[model samples]
Target: MGQLLKWLAGMLILASLACLALASWTYARSEAYLRSFERPPPFQLPIPDDEVTRARGDHLVRTRGCRGCHGDDLNGQFMWGAASAPGLPQLARGSPADFEAALRHGIGADGRALYSMPSMGFLRLRDADVAAIIAYLRSEPVIDRELPRRSLPWAIRWDLARGRDMAMPAVMNRVPPLRLEGEDSPLSRGEYFAMTTCNECHGLTLQGDSAFGDEAAPSLAVVAGYDEKAFEQLLRTGKALGDRELPRMSRVARRRFATMTDAEIDDLYAFLRQWPARTTD
Candidate 1:
């Protein structure tokens, strides 16, 4: 019996050592990918001075989660203010083209691949809208804040080493090209709104994801179940049909979608209601 117990203990130790070795390999390989991130060429957005465009751009920034990473000001912040994550660079001082590259491509000014910026979420932004975002960023107050060097935990690195969690630059490359849907129709406008904003957490197709971070977001087709009033309430308040306060979506709703104009809400609803049919077809 004593000999059997010693054998079991030995096996456990071997397993633990194997796990540690795998984790170390994962950390090193993922770090290599990040260190070798390619730099995108200079691409400029024509910064506009028009109030209407600037306002729309500002709205996009809020809804699309610029303020979530960058602070309420346009200046930099630590990634979710977590010490391990890289600090964000001050966006206000960056040229419009550099900002566009970082926003859309996940390539930084220093040419390193970003780990958490999620540029995939912003790659679908329209040309004019991109210009507007640049214009708005340029107009914001610049705050000079330096963040600590970024590092990832072993768990995240393991996921990165495996195929489960991809880097933002790779994810950005996988996104479908955005159709330049002119804003003449509600369907077009709503599709734009949903694709850009919902796609951040929802999958790129707005099909919702079972593995979105830790949450199983329902398919956006579920939006079809909501009447305009209920839908508006959900977006504006982040409460579900049962009045359950969502953890992520709720906070996002309060910060961004709550201020959506009635017309924009109407258009977004119109598009979402008709979305399931299009996805099926």
Candidate 2:
């Protein structure tokens, strides 16, 4: 009986050591990734108090869905277990340039390519609109709200370790190419709205993804299943198709898009409905 007790004790020690090793590995790996992050350019928005610019900026903020993740006050919020969004961080402290790069390139302020920021969608935004968004964010009053630090989930780490996903490289890649020409056109306007706002989660292609940072999210292209009225309803009311529980999108749409003008919604719809094929310029 004494010998059996010793064996059990030995097994427990081994299990404890394994757990310690795993914890150490996870901490070390995450730190390494964080350390490797490159700092994006400093924040700078060109527009100041120009009423036209501010109005445009407001339109940009509302239409591009900035208020979705960032709170209504632009203070920032945390959301867990959603279909499309992963754990989002508060950007109040992030510089305007950091925000711009994040919006335009999907690179975080730390310079590591953001696997999460939907830069692809924002890539199509007009320079003026992008500048306007930076302007709006700059004018927002800084509200102090502490957010829990976020990390990659264990399942994602496993996937990364097993080579199931691509590691974010240490370089700034342009967001998915956009169809907007240098001039103001219908397609360009629509593209601008989609890139800056919708693309934050939707792939640059708006193809939609199930996995952002190792969690299960839904796809937006599935909107192919929704009619325009239903789509508008989903965006404005946070209701899913047939008013089912939409979880993530509902919160975002209600918070960010509920105030969007019908014209803006129509433009966004036209862009989304004819996406990929029409916008792959």
Candidate 3:
């Protein structure tokens, strides 16, 4: 019995050491990838502590899904590699233009475009709305929550190195041109907000995206199924049409949409209530 116990203890020590080694490896790799890119311009947007803008900004952040990865408190969260790629950074203080560049361009603070951010979809947001999001981030209490280090998988790295897959900058450069001609219409402004902001997960069509699967975001088209009050409830409380619970989206609504103005909400509804025209290939 004594000998058996000794053998088991030895095995346990080996396992623990193996785990430690793997963690260390992951940390080193993540740091290497982060250092590989050039940092972006300094963050310098004027973030005021105004009552109205703060409230509006907070709402904009929630509705846009900024908290999904950044943590409910706006602290950072480490996300592991999806499909063999190394994990990536999902949090940090950023300048307004830097924030704009990231959400709008999918680029990181260090100038290298982000590979993971869904900028292709968000590049549609209006300038003011984007500023509101930045304002919210700046206004919030900065929490230094420790997050896991980030890394890029060799396969993804190879793709970037070999030119098979584009870097974040290259991917973001593909954003469709913004065509907001005409006198300002409330519906048009609202549509622009939703398209650039919500489209990241809700799908380019604002219907749904199969690309994300279960991680797939819900469709705004379903909003037509709800009355104004019900729809407002969902956004404000994260509840559903039939009082059904929505775990992911609910949290988003509570944090972000809860701050939207009635006017903004009305505008948003007016735009989302209808479907976009289908396009041909």
Q: Best-fitting candidate, measured by TM-score? A: 1
Question: Model 1 segments beyond 4 Å from truth?
Answer: 1-28, 35-41, 80-89, 154-164, 178-183, 210-212
Ranked by TM-score, the better of candidates 2 and 3 is 2
Residue-level lDDT of model 2, residues 1-281, one tens digit each, is: 99999999999999999999987786566545645545545545554657777677777777666556655666666655321232222352345576666666566666655554444556556667766765655566765666666556676555554446543432224355555657576556666676666765665445664223343345556767889899889888989888976757788787778888888778777766776565454
* TM-scores of the models, in the order given: 0.78, 0.66, 0.65
Ordering by TM-score: 1, 2, 3
Clashing pairs in 1: none
Report the candidate with higher TM-score, 1 versus 3: 1
lDDT of candidate 2 vs native?
0.62
List the lowest-lDDT window of 10 residues for candidate 2: 81-90
lDDT of 1 by residue, 1-281 (tens): 99999999999999999988987788778877776667666665556788888797788888887777667675656654332232233453456666777788887666667667767778778778888877666666655566666666667777877767776787776666544365578888888787778887888777875223457666788887789998999889989767879877788888989988898899899998988787766
274 Cα displacement, candidate 1 (Å): 1.3
CA shift of 263, model 2, Å = 5.4
lDDT of each: 0.74, 0.62, 0.63
Specify the poorest-scoring 10-residue window by lDDT in model 3: 83-92
